[model samples]
Target: MAFDSLGRFGVWRGYTGFSPEEAREYEQLGYGTLWLGGSPPADLPGVESLLAATETITVATSIVNIWVAPAKEVAASFHRIEAGFPGRFLLGIGAGHPEHTGEYRKPYDALVEYLDELDAAGVPAERRAVAALGPRVLKLAADRSAGALPYFVPSAHTAKARTLMGSNALLATENKVVLTDDTNTARTVADPAIQLYLGLTNYVSNLRRFGFTDADLAIPPSDRLFDAVVAHGTPEQVVARLTEHVDAGADHVAVQVLGDDYLPALRTLAPLLAARS
Candidate 1:
């Protein structure tokens, strides 16, 4: 079985654009899964509605924060949904940011403990995934969960992760793609989108491992910095650029189109939707 039902590619939406109607279109458009980002509240009504709306698209939490929801609540939600949606759900759980969560310490150990709780609660291992970055988390993700969904990482990091996870594990990389064609202007807008992530330890650490220096990881991101993180240009050009991650070994790529207007961007990326199997 595919480690992730993602089965090679998906779309990453900020959760605002996932209307009932648009979701139906997304499934028809051939996006195998939809990764909902942000710390959406534990209820996950959005996820349930999405799973109900689409026939094939997998509705996943890019990460459901372990601190906020707790394993018992997540397990309850999983049972409620799985009974109705079955294979349409995938859980992506992680220990989130330090400043936001407060109890931030030894994320790996915390993550493992959380997974253990989920396991004890009877949420099957195959139905869930771990949000990871760097070698240790990647290894833990492969060893304990179905796979890893790494966010804000580039092809170089994907290549490195592929080595760590080995060939059997799922490598679903979240790549930021911009539909805007303008070089300087697009990068300018994309910079802010990436700026928040720059402060994230998981993201910054991954970039460091990928060989980016402090200067490169600086705020307001330099031109080269923007280019490295955001896949900008025409649809096909961006598609070709992102393909490098797949060539390196990513089993799936969740393309997050930047600059807010996702409907048009999703249309622009329509051509590549069929690539998912």
Candidate 2:
């Protein structure tokens, strides 16, 4: 997998909230890729919109949930996007949370089946990625897709993922960021943002692997857990934390800035990311 196409870092945000204008600005700011977070549908016109808005930036789904969107449909969407944009789109697929997905069965098996369908539908393995955390799924990502796209994890998890997937595969991890120097304010802003993941077993399990105790994963995440997951501080501080993933062998880091307004933070961190590149 050629991660150079994705550059060293990218912006990860929800598809619904952002505009084409903002995406173009990110491209101008020198970010390599733009990932649309959340479980997007199979017909990813949003991918088309972003690609049309930008010139060279790669646009990918942070994850398109397999339980909700069928693989054949997703593959068709992939082909449609590829035809129009060529090498600019990546199909990121996952078997989302069991609690949230009504039809969620054995996620690993379902993911394999979905990959099989993508293969049958002519979506090449290199053009797609899997959102994985555990060793089993991470190995599967290495074997089946381009690599693993692990979310809600710390730098330690990135190191473990790189070790599991080896050097050839892509290990793109998403790190949450809040541009603030005050610890209390940063935690307060991050608390609600992270509350949703606390109920999900998959994320909780991954956090435990990072040595987070039950107290840390409580309703309002403990400072230890929040600090570890969210890179909260100045632009330089956030860049330092993001670099931890790169040093740990991550191929790319998709930064998800916390809070409603993302432009100010993106503007603040753009130069820092570009400098690291």
Candidate 3:
């Protein structure tokens, strides 16, 4: 189970600017895994440091968009990274959005074909996962790859996903959290990222699966939508929200700090979480 490979919780913060040594510090600080989400260039050089620095923490691609990262390029990177760091790497690839790239095809078919290429190139299914959010993709993740690494989903979706896939598939769900008491500023910082996802059909479809209406996923994230998926408040409160996800069904709760500066937010929780853990 990927369950044992992960910590009780993981930080899904940015790796956009941090050097690999910095990631090592986060690993030393007791964060089990780092999920790189900003879709950094698909290369092994960037991942090598993160894998080499920490002996235990698993550095994963929260997702590498298939549009930008071809299977051959990813396969080459996989072999290079795995040769050096062994099991410390996990490949997460997904078809991002039809709108973002006008050349998008039948994503499900594309994903399967991509997985086939990875398999042919000797990437083990156990060492890779897909960015999945719906029933078909989730099932595909279970049947083919290691599991699904779903982003921007609520605890309800996690629970439902677990029920659908049972104890077999790895359920790693990312949650956008803020370490603040002020609702307005937090939402203001969060609204941009949230709105960027508003038009993604895959994400919107996933929301609908969880009983959210079209109105719920409009331009700005509604209160019900925000309250359901995003967790805001103190570290303790955020932890409480994470606990709800764990209780519901998630195996790993990857936290994305919902503000401009995530370092302060992570630093605030690091000591307390590390000490208690």
TM-score, each model?
0.95, 0.98, 0.93
Most accurate candidate by lDDT: 2
Pairs that collide in candidate 2 are: none
**TM-score: which candidate is best?**
2
lDDT of model 1 at position 249: 91
In candidate 2, what are the lDDT values of residues 79-154, reduced to their tens digit?
Answer: 9999999999888999899999787799999999999999999998999999999999999999999999999998
lDDT of 3 by residue, 141-183 (tens): 8888888898888898888888877897788889988788788
The number of residue pairs in model 3 that clash at the backbone is 0
Q: Which stretches of candidate 3 lie above 4 Å from their native place?
A: 271-277
- Model 3, position 267: C-alpha lDDT score: 75
lDDT at position 27, candidate 3: 76
The per-prediction tally of clashing pairs is: 0, 0, 0
Residue 44 error for model 1, in Å? 1.6
